[model samples]
Target: MTEAEMLMEEKLRKKKEEEEEMWAEYLEQRKKQRAKEEEELRKLKERQAKRKLQRAEQESKMNEYKRKQEEQRIREMEEKKSREAEAKRKRLEEAEKKRQAMQAAKEKREQEPVKPNFVISKREGDEMGSALGSSGLDKFANIMYARGEMGKTKEQMEEDKKAILSFRVKPLEIEGLTVEQLRDMAKKLWEKVVALESDKYDLEERQKRQDYDLKELAERQRQINRSRALKKGLDPEALQGKHPPKIQVSSKYERRLDRRSFEDKRELYDGGLEAMTDAEMEKMWEDKMNSFKEQSRGQLPKWDPENPKNKQVSHIRRLEEEDDDEELVPVFEPPKPEPPKPAAPPPKPAQQQEEEEEEEEEEEEEEEEEEEEEEEEEEEEEEEEEEEEEEEE
Candidate 1:
């Protein structure tokens, strides 16, 4: 119970008071936090309930709209059905009327008496009118109408109707015309007819001449083709199917490689070209031709000597031979045309024919003698060449 002990007791008392205040403040803070959390949870529940109500309202509206659409579709179907039924009923009524009218006509025809009819001959003017088509177009128009051969489309029908209505002109009033005027008109018409007939005759003559010339041209062409086929030793039928060779597509090696004879022992630059057998070469050519034809849709240009054109250029093919170093492949060799021979004159009369034969015999003997001289000269040149070769050896 001294002064120092009293000072210590006062410090303890202050410490106890501070601890009590801290506890009270902590309890108040906890209560406020709990209240704030509870309020937030309540607001969240209210929002969720409001959204649910909105969704329900939207669903109700959608269902109502679907119901209205279904009702409209049903109503439209019913209306269309009613309209179709009404149209069908009208068509049946019309058909009945047509049938009744036809039956009445048949009955009236049956009740009427039959009579023999007289035949009438066509007038000369009418026959001429038909031949010259003076009234044929009018009759043709009538026939088209009766046969229903005119255009059935709406636009064409409108055009036809306009033509009928707008072109209904009155006939020429010959009652007011004078005799001299009528005669003059008739004369003019006759002149026009004569001119037309003359023109027609000239055209017919021209056509006949043209046809004859065409036949002659065709005959000449056939003869030329036949002669060409014979000279080339080819079948005329094969010529029809033959076509120009297709464009060649070479590989890089094929382009650069120098094709040489196998026995000639050729020097190479880069990889040398290898030679294939005759069979292999033929097979390859056939395959290439087939592929080209397929790509071109089996359509190829036929060679025409008369109208010659630039052909597709191809690489020169080399072939080995027993005698020669290289033999060129004649893939598309054109036939050399020979000069024409002069035609002999026709045979004369029997008395003159004897004289012509004697002359021909004399010409033959002279030609044979000249040919013998040429053969002797050729044999002498060959002997001289052999002698020179022996001396060189």
Candidate 2:
């Protein structure tokens, strides 16, 4: 080998060696970069998986919340339906109870025995007459008199008149009273008139007897005066006084003898039945009945005692029962008389009578003493009993 050729070959070997080192460094760098890129890709894939799991968990929570809400809504609907059903059941039960009670009452009413009704019909002759006029004002006046509320004062009369005019319509006027009330009033008036007439007749008969006695006495006095005049040998006619006393009774004496009372004349018109004959009474009764029927127009319904709606039984019977209860006085029997003692023998003389009386008085005194002793003994016995009771207590 020549020296020049050895130098060129050494230079080429050195260049080749340098090029191989650079290539090896470049490959190492490429390997490191690939590994770093792979690590980055692995980290990114893990983060993506975590996020997907969290999203799935959130979706599950949302679905659970929606399911709970649906269940709650269903439960509330069921509760509301139960409350309405309970209310409806209560209402139905109340209605059924009321219906059953009403049915029971009806059955009881039907099963009870019905009592026969007795109606006391007013007699045609017992009806009120035309004592009052045939006008509305007169009818009200009749009611006032019948009810015993006839006012004495003008103001009171006017007020009562107004009240009667304004009275509400009912089955019958005058506080819904029946026609029998007026009949009863007429009957009372008739009785009062009869009593007053009887008293007057008695007084008149007494006056007639007194007048007869007075005339007999006057005749006896005249006969005695004539006898005295004849014995004196004077004319009986000439013996009279210049002014002979008139045969008249004093007015004060007549008034004192009269027995009629003030109450007898009150409300008495034509003296009622006292002046009427039997035929006249019958005729008047018939007329009065006809008049009452005409006036009333036959609107009064017959009263039944057994009917619950009848006012006569309600008010009149209850009032009578109350009066009876109030006046239930106890009757006490009189004490029985003691048996008579044996009679003593009559005294033969006045001295014997006086001696017997003295003996009787002495015996009475001894009896009184004995009675006093007995009373004292009884009082002591009572006191001893009281003391014994106190000691026992």
Candidate 3:
């Protein structure tokens, strides 16, 4: 081989080796870059997973907190409702207890018996006993026995004895009572008696007033019946059949009358017949009237000017004064009614357009019918004339 050729070959070989080395280095660099990219991707995924987990935990905690808050609110509301219900129940119980207590007190007061200042004793055992002498002691014992037999309990007897002992006799003085105190006591007692008498008088007056009102009501009913008969064009005498009989009541011997059975008596009273004499009824009526008058006087206004109906009462008084000698004055009549207003005038022609149009149409139709009839008559006449002329020819 030529020396030049061999040198050329060796140089070519060295150049080829250098090219291969450069290729290997480039491949190694590419592999390292790919591995680095994969590691970076793994790190990013881990960080993202951690953030997601943290967000999920936060949401769960918030939900749990909300649930606890809701539970707490519900519990508070339940507690408040229970408290209110308990309070209401207690209030109702208290009210019921008060009512029961009041009823019991009223019943007790009603059941309590009225006691008098003095009592007499009766018994056979004390007949021979001491100081009063045998007959007087026997009489006292008999009285005590009689009292015991007359439905008086032992406690009631003792109370009566105590009251008798405590009572002050005439021309007697109490240790603590001065003249002024005695006078005051007497005045109070007098006033109480006066009040009782006044009450009795008022009751009588009230009864009388009620009787008057009842009579007035009966008269009014009669008048109303008569008026109704007149309106129906029936005979007024027919009202006599409808009239109720007069009722009579007793005033004296009131013990026979049981006020507790007043409702039962009302039915009998409505039958309109006297169960008592006229004198008794009159006495009762007087008592009731006096009682009512007294009550009315007591209830009168302190000052007449303060009354709402004062003006009306004053007007009544003025009317009474105008007729000084008049007794049993009649109640004032209502004012007369005002005259009725005249009816309105008829509507003008402009408002009657529809009616006018109908009338015109009817008239036109009638005229047309008449003209048609006349034409028919004329035709008939012509025909007759033609017939006659033909005959003559």
Candidate that scores best on TM-score: 1
lDDT of each: 0.69, 0.72, 0.74
lDDT of 1 by residue, 181-278 (tens): 99987897798679669869998999999999999997887778777767865555434444732322333245567354433332333233443466
The better candidate by TM-score, 1 or 3, is: 1
Per-candidate total of colliding backbone pairs: 0, 0, 30
Writing each residue's lDDT as its tens digit, candidate 2 over 1-393 gives 999999999999999999998889999998999999999999999999999999999999999999999999999999998898577556446655665686578779879999775754555644353333245666776587657544357875675455443432123344655789978866877986796698699989999999999999988988887888788655675446666434322243354563544455343444556656876878999999999989888555445454433554688889999989877976687998998987997748988889999999999999999989977876786677557756766
Candidate 1 clashing pairs, residues 3+ apart or interchain: none
- Rank ordering of all candidates by TM-score, starting from the highest: 1, 2, 3
Using all chains and alpha carbons, the TM-scores for the candidates as numbered come to 0.26, 0.24, 0.23
The model with the greatest lDDT is 3
**Can you give the lDDT of residue 146 in candidate 2?**
52
* Candidate 2 total steric clashes: 0
Model 1 lDDT at residue 29: 93
Q: Please estimate how well model 1 matches the true structure, expressed as its whole-model Cα lDDT.
A: 0.69
Model 3, span 100-163: residue lDDT tens? 6965786697799977837656666665454344476567776886676588788866755554
